[model samples]
Target: MTLNRRNFLGAGAAVAASLSAPMVLGAGKPRVVVIGGGAGGATAARYIAKGSKGAIDVTLVEPSRTYYTCFFSNLYIGGFRELSSIAHSYGKLASDYGINVVHDWAIGIDRDAKTVSLAGGAKLPYDRLVLSPGIDFVDGAVPGWDVSSQNKMPHAYKAGSQTELLKAQVEAMPEGGTFAMVAPPNPFRCPPGPYERVSMIAHVLKEKNPTAKIIVADPKPKFSKMGLFQEGWANHYDGMIDWIGQDFGGDVVEVNADEMTVSIDGEVTKVDACNVIPAMKAGKICEMASITEGNWAPVIGHTMQSRIDENIHVLGDACAQGDMPKSGFSANSQAKVAAMAIRGALTGSKVFPAKFSNTCWSLIDTDDGVKVGATYEATDEKIAKVDGFISQTGESGDLRKQTFEESVGWYAGITSDMFG
Candidate 1:
């Protein structure tokens, strides 16, 4: 079957009409169903199908045909990249890897029956299910703000239309206007994301509207690479960035979207633009599956398999995998391990012990970047970080530039690793 966007949708509709019960395994090739098609899901689908060598049937379910990554999205906001540069197509995963790419929403999972119900009414049976639905905002986490108020104060965390919307809003800011940011709490998708976003916005304002102000009301006292980011902001964007930590009313923030105002410790400040990143939890499908222990699915680290159901493996930001930060690199790393284990279980392939690694890089300005990374090995309990390195606060200009270049190369490499 030729798998293009239009053809795939037509075939999916036909399949949905016929699908009734779960296909029993052990009668034919083992089937694998992957939900969500970003870093974790896309990479897991590609690797499992490729490694299984036609021994396992792979079906990847995602709603969008094109995916935009959240990793380098700050660069897009910083005016360092174009929207097309961050967007990726799933055509290769379907045509090149012999995987069934179904563009539809996965509504529910019947774990006991080993079948997944789709929004399109299809039931896909799987010997093993890979759920990487990513993060969803926690309801009521931000007062006076909800998805409906997103147009007024964008989150831009999902890195597609919201990202574009935020960018356009930032560009449209009036001269010398105030831009406010309400960052998330702990255990969000990326540890450095909010700070990196602040830097990117500072970069844009520095060039476009130098007199404008950027106010950050953060719930946390400190953030990832705090020293480096603080240093960079001091050196590069002094007097323009006002960061309010938890100690100074940053933790107690309320927003009036209708009035375009933010209240920090009851001191209301009117702003021209706002970006609110609320607390997040595992995507809704995780709850639908009844596999989630709390907000996140608990997974056995060695194999990325659900501690609740061995037949299912949860990867990326949606899983509570110890010591692994929720980032694109961590998700892609976890995907390979899950892929290998699934192949071994289904196709009788050799599976090695899981090893994971991640490096989070943030660009402070043009050719100014810093990074923190670690290599990890799975223990009996969790994935534990082994050796790690972080960019020094007083690093040389040359070294910082080199780090930025490395991040550029990494963005190219990891996106290819995920999509292709």
Candidate 2:
């Protein structure tokens, strides 16, 4: 399925249904506890509540009151968008859908008891638990770098204050200074995210400090939309970006946050700004619940249920579902599937075959955008990709502009779908 504005809107509409008669399992309504109020959790909560029509009780646990989307944070870094533009609230999900929105950190999970322990000393009991807590950086994945050094070398991957800090650091760079980026390896959140950040940083530097240089040391030999990003870099910001992949010792890297320096291939270079995106793992809650297999929770594609425990469903970047990249669109797609399954299980609603789709859009410069996406279906083993498409190199300017516009529309539509 080609994912356009019409299809996006149609998908959102499809998730909406009339009230269904729910099975009375106990004294109260079927309870669903969803952790992480980002794309997957928010969408799942909204879909379940809307589809069930008071049949299911949904409680969403998230730490932040204002959720900043990682999808468009790069554009905020490039000054194309304001900081407020990416920030979202759970107001709609609560006011419109009647979801019990709890602002707190989920510290522990007792899978045997089907309860989640919050940092505020509250316990949430659930008939079904949805874990969509997103990614957490692997400790020691990047040598000499950790959360403590985030002020000096901001990861900005979580898209909040770190994003503001990184943008401030970039704008504060001295003339002719170097900006360094340590990109993470594969199976991380948003495959094209780090590269898109580079483009946004380059875009900023080209306008403010033209002589400033950008260096990216990536452990991966190749990245998503490589050809398109390379072409855009050459066309828009020539001689401003240097990308060193694994072949060039980019894999052998370390950082000295105190010295504001990076060591790639044993060569040290001082940098004014550094964005250290370390290797990622499933959010800590998955491990706490003992559902993780080597950093991620394995899930059945048909229902997004944890392989270890069927009562728990894992979505988004935390799950090891096959084929789909770790992206907001992928998570949103998975959430609907999980929502349908949960509704079916709890309310005896009709269940349909699972279908998924994702489209990742990247902005190279003003009005210059590209995208890659695919359609997927749930097989017995995995969420297998059916077909895919990408923006070709040397595309016409009009098409690129159209693609960027399409992405803007998607952001609006998806946010509405998730939060409402």
Candidate 3:
């Protein structure tokens, strides 16, 4: 199907013009169901509820009351920001935005009937559905690593209890104990995230336990912000960080959580702490809804609508957007495009193609930051990047602090756009 996305959700009278004040129509107005309330789903719900006015009945099914964005979560883990600052409620979207936010999980979707079945066993029928369920880990992809073992080895990728548990483990480890990080392969959420997290943890180790060491076992040979991370480690930790890339027999295949060791190249390295960020796939809702094939759900990019089923739209880290990394910033930007597409799909209006942009920042030390950003456009089939995307090249006093300032400003703005 042909798709388009317009960033212009017109201001002022646009709402008044879209439909009369509190317009009423059972058939003409569509029942739109949005699943998940992370970066993508929440933004989609707010915009669709605002722009549609009383024209559409919008209900968002999300499991959590508050969202902690993965975009800047590392800052919180590193002690640079408070958890309260990272956590946000859906009060804005629920109260001011005029959307019904349901506290529940979407267990199944009937594409033929165009309805969503919740875990509570209620059948909520819909004219169209928007799903941005984020991601779920594939079972048994990593040998000796299963859901049961995850409690001992926290992935901390989802950002919440697991994150807290992981952080507490790192904090409680014996002084000079080894902190091992099992990095996932590429095409995972936040490509630079694992390394940046390691950098921050190393920072923690340096001030508290100078002899503490960090061992990162990677399945990939190289990573994002390599030079900057190396430089920071050299200056700050005295090379206390040891990275074993896949080239250096560091391709981890299995783990023994009870033993606190991970196997790489037929060898096991015991450690006091382990943060194994395994591979990811579309969230459970997608699997229940049958919208996913393997790790991702396929979608038409211009509109962020599902390619398999036109009435359903998918966005964020869960959707198969080839060009963008699975970052919260990417999800937030894509939500705008998805919202417009949902509006058009409901009203039968002409859809406009979309362009997207995202910037991800990682802090290495106090007042020191690194960033990677990109520009993108949506084609009829997939999301692809435009030229000129760049990353922080080197460590300097000015550039580092400047990026920190920018990171702070970004949190302020995006949170405002999302929850403010």
Best TM-score among the predictions, by candidate number: 2
Q: Give the TM-score of candidate 1.
A: 0.93
| Cα RMSD to the true fold for all candidates | 6.4, 8.1, 5.9
TM-scores of all models? 0.93, 0.94, 0.91
Where in model 3 is the C-alpha error above 4 Å? 1-27, 348-350
Give the clash total for candidate 2: 0
Q: Give the per-residue lDDT digits (tens) of candidate 3, residues 1-420.
A: 111111113234464466544441332456788898888888788878887776777898988897887777777778887778888888878788778889888888998877788889888878778898888887776778777877888888988877778778888889889898888877788888998889778877888777888888888888887887877777767778999999987775678998888777787778888888887888988877777867788988888878778888888888897688888788889988988887887776557779898888888888888788888998775788896544455657897898889989988888878664
- Candidate 1 vs candidate 2: the lDDT winner is 2
Candidate 2 has its poorest 10 consecutive residues by lDDT at 18-27
Per-residue CA lDDT of model 2 for 263-361, tens digit only, reads: 999999999999999999999999999999998999999999999999999999999999999999999999999999999998899999999999999
Candidate 2 structure, TM-score to reference: 0.94
Q: lDDT of each model, Cα atoms only?
A: 0.91, 0.93, 0.80
Which candidate model has the greater TM-score, 1 or 3? 1
Model 2: lDDT equals 0.93
Q: Order candidates by TM-score, high to low.
A: 2, 1, 3
TM-score of 3: 0.91
Q: What are the clashing pairs of model 3?
A: 4-352, 4-353, 5-352, 5-353
**What are the runs in model 1 whose C-alpha is more than 4 Å off?**
1-26
Q: Is candidate 1 or candidate 3 better by lDDT?
A: 1
